[model samples]
Target chain A: MAKPLILVTNDDGITAPGVRTLIHIMKKIGDVIVVAPDSPQSGMGHAITLDSTLYAEKLTIDEESEGIVEYSCSGTPADCVKLALQELMERKPDICVSGINHGSNSSINVIYSGTMSAAIEAGIEGIPAIGFSLCDYKWEADFSQAKEYVQTIVEQALQHGIPKGTVLNVNIPKLTKDELKGIKVCRQARANWKEKFDKRKNPMGKDYYWLTGEFELLDQGEDTDEWALANGYISVVPTQFDLTAHHAVQELNSWNF
Target chain B: MAKPLILVTNDDGITAPGVRTLIHIMKKIGDVIVVAPDSPQSGMGHAITLDSTLYAEKLTIDEESEGIVEYSCSGTPADCVKLALQELMERKPDICVSGINHGSNSSINVIYSGTMSAAIEAGIEGIPAIGFSLCDYKWEADFSQAKEYVQTIVEQALQHGIPKGTVLNVNIPKLTKDELKGIKVCRQARANWKEKFDKRKNPMGKDYYWLTGEFELLDQGEDTDEWALANGYISVVPTQFDLTAHHAVQELNSWNF
Candidate 1:
């Protein structure tokens, strides 16, 4: 029997405590390869480096894990996954896991998430993938609490396999292990950011704006990811890349084109 | 009757002929407001500006349209929409139309499309939206050929109202009006890019790579966007933001997490 080869990547850069904790857990499970951005790419969705050159460097991040390979990429999270699958890895990973991100990627945040984007990228390439996120967003946020839950989800994904044409977006509530309620497989909640621009003037007296927002949950559904997270449960939403609204196809066909 | 306020935007930057053509057509249909990126942002996907200050300035791209308001943003397509809705536009638009893009955003390409991202952003903001793209990628591609179809689709989308939870992903084949078959409502084809990294040594003797890929269509579905485009018809896929694979939620719940 061979250990499953796991590819690890994230949006919080290679040195973030979130990803570092993720790497530690993945090591205990299988062979690990870390190909992640060299800098933070927090809101970088599924962006690929189309107009620029990409640079990836082999780095020795974990000295103790003699078999673990790592690469630092000068691109977005999606780019890292592409570079890893096409150039860095000797073979396709058994599963690609992104994040343990410093903040949540549940609900509408998934649309702007670099963490989920990496996992989705792997899913597009026919690999089973999962994106893990902690509800806390601080640079020094404690990622240690979610380690046990993270390992269990990955193990279960490998055993039962993720549903085809989708990847898991697992967001753990920021709570102590004892306080955590457990895992909940849920649908993405309908919600969006109620954006507020913090207007400010630069030294040159030119007005510039900082994009900030508050999460506004629009759905009251109990089965939604937001509801699960609010109840102290780790939420797993099966996210898809095929953006088609299939239900609308029939109605659209009735329209006069 | 008050004119339908149509918000116009694209990934091809503010001055591209594709958007310019789109603006020309939109002016006839409604009170137009243009908020797009200052430079080409193709393949930027659903990215938003988080770590940087956003700068947007009023611009006069079309002088004759005295009532039309336009702003050029120093950010991604998604950011442009957020700025328009949050800061620039005085009122909520009746509809948001993105692109008249220089290239196709059908099938798997939608996963990496800044054009569709803008439309999807507007949809997330509770506006009826549509993203239009031409199959041609050349800068000077004849956007004029698709003008009639573009106008018709926008008009239809405005009247029909995009399905709840979805926007329209419209792709036009690069054909003269006479050659083009009628529009077809279709599903996104199951497809992905088979990535190839163009590795090279930079002038600094550092290894760099250019990401390239060939579109691999894995689906033989006749009702897919690819099929319609191949047959010289315009393709309209109702695109959703909820990303949740609803069918898979039940199966994932069966996992022992």
Candidate 2:
């Protein structure tokens, strides 16, 4: 049987330590191909390059390791998936995974996440996909502690394919392997960031602002992704791309058009 | 009674004819504040700025339009709404309006629209929001035909608030006022764009690709955005920020943790 072909991409630039760790771990499981943003696309949600052109380049970072087929793209995470499947990859990947991102994409933040967008893009194309993120935001954040858990989850997901119209949003708590609790399959927590801007002036003495926010978790449920991460466990929330409000449809149906 | 404060934003940049038209319509109804992107964001989706600092400045294209606060943001449409609500606006806006976008953001494109993202951001803030789009894609697309319909809809929306957790995804047909029918409240049409990449070599002999697609409608029902737009009627699909597949939730609940 042919080894499972795995496609890996991330919102962080191709050289980020996070994707490097993902590439190493994925090699142990299957044939891995890396197609990722040329620059950081952290909050780029489901954006695709429609109005502009996209550039891609084949690159080699190391000769010591079994060379992973890699391409750095000048597009959003979703664009990378489209390019990989449409232009680069010779065969469709058996499994597509995004991230091992340096920050969490759980709950409401998922709606503004580039990491999850890649996973969603793959899922839209009928491929089983997963997006993994660590709660830490530091550039040199430790990803090794989450590696073993990631391998276990990816192996299981590939073995038992994900359900149609669904992709996994796997967020690992930033903790040592021994300190980490086992994985918990959970639902997305109802939460949103309370946005607060940091207002400042530029060198020209003109007013400018930086978008910053404080995370405010309104939901106190124990089954939420926030709760799981808080308790030092990995959370796997099954996310879907359809934005339809099925329940609201009934109410909307009653409205006079 | 205090006049309702209308916050206007769009992905097509501050100078797009679509947004200028929106600004005009909104100004007539209420005190309008325009917080929009500095450059066209088109398919930028729900992206936010995280890796780099954001810059927003008070903009004045004409002295005639005074006292109405306007800011040009250096981020995605989602970032614009977040900034507007957090820093620019003195108080919570009564309503948020995004777009009169140059191209269609109906159906599946809603998942990949920066215009709709602005509306969704406003919805998350518990503010009534709507994103308007024109079926035409030209830079000079005439939005005059949409004025009366848009004004009526906005007036109605302000009079009767949108249901909680919902925003309006409104797409108008590109037609003269005489040619257009009335508005149709509908559901998102099940549709997708079959992507085609034009791969080419640059002067440096490096490969680059342009993203293009032909939209394919899979739904034949008249109660859909595509159907409404095709029939020369304004389409309003009440959208929601909660992306949970509630039906799948039951099956997911049955899964072993």
- How much DockQ does model 1 earn? 0.89
The true-versus-predicted C-alpha distance at residue A90 of model 1, in Å, is: 0.7
Off by over 4 Å in 2: A63-65, A253-257, B62-67, B250-257
Instruction: Candidate 1: give the TM-score of chain A.
Output: 0.97
Please provide, for model 1 over B1-257, each residue's C-alpha lDDT reduced to its tens digit, 9 standing for 90 to 100.
79999999999999998898899999889899999999999999899999899999997976665667888999999999999999999999999999889999999999899999999999999999999999999999998877878888888888888899999999999888899989999999999999999999989899999998999999999999999999999999999999999999889878887
| Single-chain TM-score of chain A, each candidate | 0.97, 0.97
Error of 2 at A67 (Å): 3.4
Among all candidates shown, the one with the greatest DockQ? 1
The CAPRI category of model 1 is high
State the C-alpha lDDT per candidate: 0.93, 0.87
Model 2 over residues B94-143: C-alpha lDDT tens digits?
99999989999999899899899999999998899999999999998999
TM-score of each: 0.98, 0.94
List the lowest-lDDT window of 10 residues for candidate 2 chain A.
Answer: A248-257
Displacement of the residue A43 alpha carbon in candidate 1, Å: 0.3
| Candidate number of the best lDDT | 1
Per-model root-mean-square deviation over C-alphas: 1.1, 2.1
Model 1, A68-96: lDDT tens per residue? 78899999999999999999899999999
